[model samples]
Target: MQETLTRLTFPLSTTSAPCSEEEFVARFNQRPGKEARMGYDCPLCRNKEFVLRVENGFHRPYACRCVTIRQNLTRLRNRGLLELYERCTFENYHVTEEWQRGARDCALSFQKSPLDGWFFISGPSGCGKTHLCTAIASQLILSGHDVQIHRWVEWAAQAKAAVTDSGAYAALVQPLKDCEVLYLDDFLKVQHGTRPTAADIRLAFEVLDTRYNTPDKPVLLSSELSLRQIAALDEALAGRIAERSRNHAVQIGSAPGRNYRFK
Candidate 1:
């Protein structure tokens, strides 16, 4: 019975294991397409298709390395971790010739070494802080690193919720903690026309403290706040970020006749 069962489950081939002739007949009857179609023969072992039991079920297709490679490429692209430049619209980014050069240089630097240190882009509103940061993120992702982009306000809200609702909070926190590169878009001291509240200050401090002082991963902050203004928002947090970052700060400003890309 065991011998018959084995033959019934697997197709017979020259390279295939031996089984009772009755089992082969039973399997041929049970599997509608087994007989009419070419019998299972290992592609690697022979030039024909073979039956392989994959996780889901029996596949009457020979294993091809190309399938695995294609699947991996599809997964990487779908994850939005590749094709970073395509994700952000670059032609829409407006900046002066000099600032554009600087932005390109920063992007190249990040592409080469995404784990270097924190990057803080700060300046007045409409100066393309977020655009440049997004560009950097896109470049890093194309280079095969995991990247996360978030708005400052959105992150603040999640952190606040995490304080009270641990589960919901962990959903946000775990990603931030695990991501290879984190981009905080429009980071600043105010939200909804109000100055940074006590809670806001605490939340910012906790995130920066954990990321900068603990495992010491790189973070990117795009903000309209100037360096001095940032320092004023939370002196300790600003000080720590400044001390830990490589470039200290990046100031993006507008040149006359240039349209702002961040608006």
Candidate 2:
């Protein structure tokens, strides 16, 4: 895909023709048929203006940056995150404790270089874990990467409902493995002192193992359980999650004013 984009963009980069922003717009405002088909409002160029230029005596097309943003927005909307799109942003995430501030900074860093690895955020309910997770997801989306956010229990319920039909189950959970970035919000909400059932382990293993095996696909998790608690759920499943998320693990609770829900 990068190769394809490079091929398409090479011609535009080769020559210096547009003297100014106005000239660029005046000369190349023609939108591509493909862009029109996508139904975006000139996001690729970062501006509504697109360019079709005769550079080096060859006609070349360029997409607007707005198109890229719109594409990212579409990915979020497709994955049921569109509602959270506006509410979850770095600027909106409140930080009342030192740890919360640190966590927010870490999320910002992830936004800058998300390809580093996955993130595992553990905290009590209302500690703003979901807010932080969604903020990171939102930033990544704006950066033009595909992202999917799902509450773990809800996803599991949906997956389990398809148990009678093998094809339905596969269709339901396959995206958890395939998306470029996945945010498993409220992960593993099992009752305390009761170990996760075998069925739970099986489902968790399938999703976690697939994402862990694919190094490029980073998974973000926000859970109430600590890493130790998660390991207790199922050693094998938690091991898979831990191995990939080791460096990026963040614990944010027990500090003064850690919970942001009231704030």
Over 1-263, each residue of candidate 1 has an lDDT whose tens digit, in order, gives 34543453533343242655545433433343222211122222232123233222232334333333333335446655345445554555654576665665565565466677787777666566666777766556434455666677867876776788888877877777666677777875465678877888777776677787556487998777765677887788878777766553566665564322211
Provide the global lDDT of candidate 2 against the true structure: 0.71
Task: Give the per-residue lDDT of model 2 (tens digit) for 45-80.
Answer: 425334555565444555445555677777666777
Question: What do the candidate models score in CA lDDT, each in turn?
Answer: 0.59, 0.71
Q: List pairs with backbone clashes in candidate 1.
A: none
Which run of 10 residues does model 1 get worst, by summed lDDT?
34-43
Q: Cα lDDT of model 1 overall?
A: 0.59
| Candidate 1 TM-score to native | 0.60
TM-score, cand. 2 vs. native: 0.74
